[model samples]
Target chain A: MREPTVRTQKIKKDTTRTRLIFFGILALILIICSVFCEYLTPYDPYLQDLKNAKAPPSLSHLFGTDRYGRDMLSRVIVGSKASIFSTLLLVGLVTVLGTMAGVFGGWHGKRIDTVLMRISDMFLAFPGLVFAMAVAGVLGGGLQNAIIALMAISWPKYARIARSETLVQKEAPYLKAARLSGSGTLKIVFKHILPNIIGPILVTSMLDIGTMMMELAGLSFLGLGAKPPTAEWGSRMSDARSLLSSAPWVTLSPGVAIFISVMIFNLLGDTIRDYADPKSRGR
Target chain B: MDQPALKVSHLTKVFTRKGQPDFTAVDHVSFSIQAGECAGLIGESGSGKTTVVNMITRLLDPTGGSIVLNGEDITRMRGKELRKVYARMQMVFQTPAESFDPRCTLGDGIGESLRNNGRSRRETRDEVARLMEVCGLSADFASRYPHQVSGGECQRAAIARALAIKPRLLICDEATSSLDVTIQKEIIALLNKLRREKDSDLSILFICHDIALVQQFCNRVLVLYKGKIVEQGEVDAVIRNPQDPYTRRLIDSIL
Candidate 1:
């Protein structure tokens, strides 16, 4: 057993509270963008504007026009729906599957653990992007398919993390105390180990959301994602690449959109990591 | 004489690390405690004090031993049978804070043993309060989490939990070592009070590194040196007229 550290007084002004508020606002904005994408944009992103082709940023068009005369601002706004949707779906699937697999693998050692971990190891051998790309290639091109592809490779990291956390938690004195007091194996794993390790997994999933979104964008740019006319960020970037010299805003708009979204997710993930850390609390 | 509350015969425990030679943790230790007797096992750290306690409480499997409680041999018990045996013999750990679940409230922690033994929630609630009252805890502490309480309060909570099951034997593994001097005294006094008031046939196996503490609480003392018992006698005799060299050294250190 570890010795108890001296309890420090709680700070009057909490930096963590401020960070949570900031992240909450960013998350709210992304949610709003996702739910009201169509109503928020003035012009249809798919409607071509031949008359205003390759126009610079001005009062009439906030992000100007693209090579095909499409409204770049409208495209970026509407594109968030697909990006956020796919990333969230991918994260949700991976978290549930990974946590269960990890808990079972850690709790029941020997043959079951060996088999589960071997599968995890096999997934780990391949780079996540390459595995996702291969899965995407085999499954063919679509939003749902892309999410499935990402999850196939993404779940291994979470499983490995959960398994290790479970292994450590299983040996804690409280767990033994619980067992001695007659808590069944299911109750011990779910009630004690799950709650203790879920915080880290949640933070990891939040960070993974940003990565999944980027991956989705990359796939779409390669013509393997949400197809043209769907107004996805990657598809827009793909269309604008050829006309980079004449219409730099076309490329820059989607690039900035992806950058801001990823930054918000990363910041949110960092704050969650700090807040969930037991060492940071009661200091 | 009435049947002994706990009986141990030829208890031996050996621990072997991977690719390392086997080491004896407890070498042929044997002892017995009558109902309501307080027996102390005194040793320095790594002297197998806890190892003996663990084997007796069924936390660790003894390599070769037979433990008979009330004429029942529990040396080979497993699963539900082992758990049933545990219900009759509870343990209070050295670190009070670590003994109780951090996530659970004090009352819940105390009530857990009862719940595990198949007591209903309502019955557990009432019994937990009664146990706490006996252990000198307020009813309001039932809702307070482990972290909210002081070290002394947590230790009291642990004692209350141990008593909840109405066990025939209580194994305290350096139970009050983590407490302050004043708190330790208070806990000792509380234990003595409870023992007298209940008139319970509760045998206590008090394991500690401090011989002085054992002298204050225990009727008999067993001195252990390097996983082997060097001396066993009345506390006064063992402390005052020590025959073993290890016992003399321990007494000199305390004095």
Candidate 2:
């Protein structure tokens, strides 16, 4: 019985490893495409052709043409730079900022912890998108403003995770040992605290990539994110929304692009989490 | 008169809660270890042995007391000053494996203090190897993580880490209690070797509930009961003729 169980566990481990590599490659490819999208597009995304407006999918234009006569495939390939990169940037910014704030608060718990945690609580209390809209509106709507808005609302979650993890690690004897070894506060936090607490934070950030992308697109759809002529996936979809019934391809093109990329990223995040967790490796 | 290596006067720790009265864990405990002396603090669980160790290591603030390490008053030290005092004193915790950062190798943990104190990388590496060897661990054990090593080996590594900076005072808070009987004897032997070799400089404050182990390792003994020192004297004297009821009970309970 034990032998069978061990064999099954080994099989499961192999499958997860294979899946991890598969999704990792797919995500990497998506990122690579977004980076070199300019060279990859067959047609200039911005160049309009009134003659081909609202044309259905064909061999020449695989995703059809929008009302502005922009090739849907070309537009999507170009839009990825803004859509994917901005989301990645937003996630990076929040992860760093939040983890810093959390570690600081957790390390020095007193008036500072109370104040910082309360501030995070205030951000968490608000509906995330609504707060982003309000912030974006106040900052004068643009992709940059929209990113700032999302960052302001998104960082609190990472902060919460990092803060809690830091709190748990704060009581570990190793920290005291480090302190006794003449390590200063910064050294202890960076060398001992951060490395131990980073696993959960990394997983959380990886999982947040897809959610953040969708939220960024949501902001663009609401006219708070990427503006017209920017070739952003959300704004492109928003621009073609009225053509849903007559020219469904126009609206569906960006939507499908968003769907495919989100699925890849989400699956990659799940695989990474599985890979990181030792217990999940079929123990 | 020479100052003791470690001296605590009227130490106390009160745990304050939201609606309940403050509970005192260590109540006005006082003790001192002369240079080169091995002083044992024996107490049952929740009898405030850990509280005293925590207070001495400055991991917990005493409600009312002063801690003097190496004849310098470190009771009010903070930040850089407190960190500087760590060079003179160090502690080994109950759980050997948990006393080290899980992410760091044993070598890193051992060399951490040396590097922090401005030693060159090459010097740190050489010193770590020497310390590992001195603590009965081979140089190859440096690359092994705490989880990969046996309890005795990890405890030895922990000892190596504590000894890296050559602290004048070593506080062992039930360091060997977590190990099995054979391993515990081995750790006690190691501590005994260190004490004999450094008899002129290093002082040890060995904390444990095992009266037999304390008698074997410690010269002086302080028996703690309900946050108070019920009795204290030479290890042999106290063991043979206990003064307080708690002390007698403690000695009787220890087989």
Best by DockQ: 2
C-alpha positional error of residue A271 in candidate 1 after TM-score superposition, expressed in Å? 2.2
* TM-score (second chain) of model 1: 0.97
Q: lDDT at A53 for candidate 1?
A: 88
- Candidate 2 per-residue lDDT, tens place, B96-199, comes to 99988999998999999899899999999999999888889989998988889998999999898888889999999999999999999999999888878886
- CA lDDT, candidate 2, residue B157: 91
Q: Which parts of model 1 are misplaced by more than 4 Å?
A: A1-14, A36-75, A109-119, A227-229, A243-251, A278-282, B1-3, B71-73, B118-122, B236-245, B252-255
lDDT at A199, model 2: 94
Clashing pairs in 2: none
Task: Mark the 10 consecutive residues where model 2 chain A has the least summed lDDT.
Answer: A5-14
Report the TM-score of candidate 2, chain A only. 0.94
TM-score of chain B of each: 0.97, 0.98
| Candidate 1 lDDT, B1-255, residue by residue in tens | 488999998899999898999999999998898889999999999999888987887778999979998778999888778878877888888888877766778888888878878899999999999989999999999999878889999999899988888888888899889898999999999988877876857889899888889999999999989989999999998888999999999999969
* TM-score (C-alpha, index-matched) for candidate 1: 0.86
TM-score of chain A of each: 0.89, 0.94
The DockQ for candidate 1, computed on C-alphas, is 0.36
What are the Cα lDDT values of the candidates? 0.86, 0.91
